[model samples]
Target chain A: SQQGEEDPQALSIQEGENATMNCSYKTSINNLQWYRQNSGRGLVHLILIRSNEREKHSGRLRVTLDTSKKSSSLLITASRAADTASYFCATDETGGAQKLVFGQGTRLTINP
Target chain B: NAGVTQTPKFRVLKTGQSMTLLCAQDMNHEYMYWYRQDPGMGLRLIHYSVGEGTTAKGEVPDGYNVSRLKKQNFLLGLESAAPSQTSVYFCASRRPGTGRFYNEQFFGPGTRLTVL
Candidate 1:
């Protein structure tokens, strides 16, 4: 079963605009991670936010976590054409073997 | 160091055939995982290992088996291939964390498998 569900199954934005993707999960999580995958390639770990952390930033990426609502969001500041990719959210469920359950993902397209 | 690598980037097998996918990581990670990605399904865990000589089933373990004889290698096998098993398989490895949280996982390029 899928632990997380991403909103806006697909998003298209201009290159200079900011792109935000949201993910909501069902159960409590030890941490939440965001990954980016280019077409026909493996995923790359972008950022991770622990349950105790409300927000985190890495380069052009910012991740926010809200354990109370079981939701998280990823913000790509000043999106670039190179940033076009599929983004997925994964959750490490509490009490489990630390296995990650992923969301369906949001396909983001940055138009130049 | 090569973080993680998978063998046979692409493969095609007829129904009822068997094959094994190999995953090797040079980071000496303690945890290894296998996942399959399909359209609209994202990535689903197939099997995982905590250490050498240890293996455990994941969400979709049916028709699949795994082995971890060496700390740096994890193998996923298919006893009998089915069309439903056609998907892109990815292998990931991560070092164990000190506390409850786990470190980030490094993923391989992935293997594209097509079952007819």
Candidate 2:
């Protein structure tokens, strides 16, 4: 079963606009990581936010985690056509077994 | 360096047929995993190996089997193909990070399997 669920199953936006996606998980996590998948390709690691931390940034991507709510959000500023892809959030449970549970994912499209 | 690679990018199998998908990693990661992706289902774990010669079931282990005979290779096998087993399969490997935490996993290109 998927431990996380993403909101806005799909999103479409024009270039230069900001895009935001949210993910909610059921159990405590050691860390939450975001990944991106291009059409018909494997996923690429984007960014990882540790449980102890609340927010993280990399380039045009920003991620905020709220453990109290068991949810996280990914923000992409100034979206571009190339930024269009499926985004997924994976959680590593807070226990001995280090396995990642993934969410359904949000498909984002950036129109040029 | 070809972080991770999967064999047979695409395949079609008849119901009741069997096949094995191969996955390899060159990062010398100690952890390897197999996952299946279906439309609207993101991805679900099939099995995982923490080290060579050791394997464990994941969230979705039924209808699938896995083997990790080598540290850098993981294989997933379907004994009896079914229409419901048709999906995109992904293989990933990861190494432990500082403390007991783990680093991000590297995924293969994925293999598309179809059963009719």
Candidate 3:
């Protein structure tokens, strides 16, 4: 069974706009991670927010975690055409041997 | 240095044929994993290894086999290719720290496999 689910399966936005993606999970997690994947390519780790932390930021990326709601959101500011890719949220359970459970992902398209 | 690399960016196999996919990581990660991605489905883990010479089954491990004979290498094999196995395969590696939240998996360029 999938542990994480993302809302708005697809999104299209213009350049310089801000894009937000949401993910909701079932169980308590140690951390939530966001990754980006270009068409037919590998995934690049974007940001990681620990369970103890409510929010984190890295460059133009911001991640927020709400353990009470079992949800996380990723915000990319000033999006560009290069940002067109699929974004995924992965969760690691709260224990040893952190096995990742990934969400279905949100496909974002940035129109230049 | 190459982070994580998978060989044969694309492959085509016929029914009943067998093949193996190779994944190598230069980061000297202690953990490795194999996953398959079908359309609409996120990713399903096939097998994983915590260390060299050890392997464990993941969520969807019925038709796949894995080996981690070397510290920097992991292998995923298909005994008999089936059309249903056609999908994108990704290999990931990580050096998880002993902390509450340290799972960061680095993925390799996926292999697009097609079985007929």
Candidate 3 scores an iRMS of: 1.3
* Clashes by residue pair, model 1: none
> Fraction of reference contacts reproduced per prediction?
0.66, 0.64, 0.68
User: lDDT tens digits, residues B44-103, model 1?
Assistant: 999999999999999999999999999999999999999999999999999997234678
Worst 10 residues of 3 chain A by lDDT: A90-99
Model 3 interface DockQ = 0.73
Tell how far residue A80 is off in model 2, in angstroms: 0.7
For all predicted structures, in order, the TM-scores are 0.98, 0.97, 0.97
Query: Per-prediction DockQ scores?
Result: 0.70, 0.66, 0.73
Candidate 2 C-alpha lDDT tens digits along B27-115? 99999999999999999999999999999999889999899999999999999999999999999999966322668999999999999
Ranking by DockQ: 3, 1, 2
Off by over 4 Å in 1: B98-100
TM-score of chain A of 3: 0.96
Which candidate has the top score in DockQ? 3
lDDT of 2 by residue, A1-112 (tens): 7888999899999999999999999998889999999999999999999999999999999999999999999999999999999999999888637688999999999988
Tens digit of lDDT per residue, candidate 3, span B1-116?
A: 89999998999999999999999999999999998998778887889998999999888998899999999999999999999999999999999664564868999999999999
Chain B TM-score, candidates in order: 0.97, 0.95, 0.96
